[model samples]
Target: MKVVVDTNKCQDHGQCVFAAPDVFRLDEAGRLAYVSGPDESLRADVEDAADVCPLQAITLED
Candidate 1:
């Protein structure tokens, strides 16, 4: 699965990180960093991350 987060829409609130730590995280500068192509086993967590993203920035593409 492929994941994409719209940086323009994201506020760096870290909701995605809490939902899917394996795929999303904060960088040294406190910016959002993520795995664009995470393992398929992480799809569910990614989906949950997308759901919890208040800014609606997370997108999942198969």
Candidate 2:
């Protein structure tokens, strides 16, 4: 699976980080950062992250 985040819409809320720490995180500057392509086994967690993102900035693609 592939992860995509719209930087324009993101506000560094870090909800995705709480939902999927292995795939999303806050950089030293408190900005959003993530793995663009994560293992398939992490699909569920990624989905949850997308769901929890307050800004709806997370997208997933095959």
State which candidate has the highest lDDT: 1
Cα-based TM-score, every candidate: 0.95, 0.96
Candidates in order have lDDT scores of 0.96, 0.94
Residues 1-62, candidate 2, lDDT per residue (tens digit)?
Answer: 99999999999999999999999999999998899999999999999999999999999999
Candidate 1 ranges with C-alpha deviation above 4 Å = none
Give me the candidate number with maximum TM-score: 2
Query: Model 1: what TM-score?
Result: 0.95
Query: How does residue 41 of candidate 2 score in lDDT?
Result: 92
lDDT of 1 by residue, 1-62 (tens): 98999999999999999999999999998899999999999999999999999999999999
Which pairs in model 2 have colliding backbones? none
Worst 10 residues of 2 by lDDT: 15-24
